[model samples]
Target: MDKKLIEELKLKLLEEKKDLEKILKGFAKKDPHTPGGWRANVPKYDGGHMEEESDEVEHYQNLLSQEASLENRLKEIEEALDKIQTGKYGICENCGKEIEIGRLKTYPAAKTCLRCK
Candidate 1:
């Protein structure tokens, strides 16, 4: 892989990591007990109004779903950044082959090459 390409991918991954963290912070709280972990904030309801309670619960559920998805993506990005540091980025984890440059450009965190995927 070209050094320039690797550098570009690193920049892309860093930018993506920043964006993911920003999005996660909007609807989730960082768990103090867990490293790089987050939890969706539960909606608070007042006066025990049944309808309002249900609405709040529904909103909480939606946020939880989004949080899980974002957390997984963030993890992958972190792993990719780590691999870069170890001089192992852009290799397909499943096949030990170089991942296509186009794929790396499209998804810097990809763990598999086109054939392995």
Candidate 2:
């Protein structure tokens, strides 16, 4: 891969990481127990109506799902950045082939080529 192209992808991955962290911070906190882990904030409980409590539980569940998704994406971005450092960016992990430039441009965090994916 061209050094310049790799640099561009690295920037994209960094930007994505920042954006994901920002979104996660809105409703989640970093988990000190696990590196790169996030925990969705549980809604506060008070002496309230049963219906309201149910709604809060539902919302908390939704947040948990979203947090998991965002964290997975962030992990992929981090892995891609590490690959860049190791001079293995843009190579498909499954097939050991060069990933299509277009695919990499579309998703810098991609781990597999379109075929493998």
The pairs that clash in candidate 1 are: none
Q: In model 2, which residue pairs have backbone atoms overlapping below 3 Å?
A: none
Best by TM-score: 2
TM-score, cand. 1? 0.93
What's the lDDT for residue 36 in model 1?
49
Which TM-score value belongs to model 2?
0.96
Give lDDT tens digits, candidate 1, residues 1-117.
Answer: 899999999999999989999999998888967554997777777869798888888988898888888889999999999999999999999989999999999989999999999
Can you tell me which runs of candidate 2 are displaced by over 4 Å?
A: none
Report lDDT (Cα) of residue 26, candidate 2: 100
Give the number of colliding residue pairs in candidate 1: 0
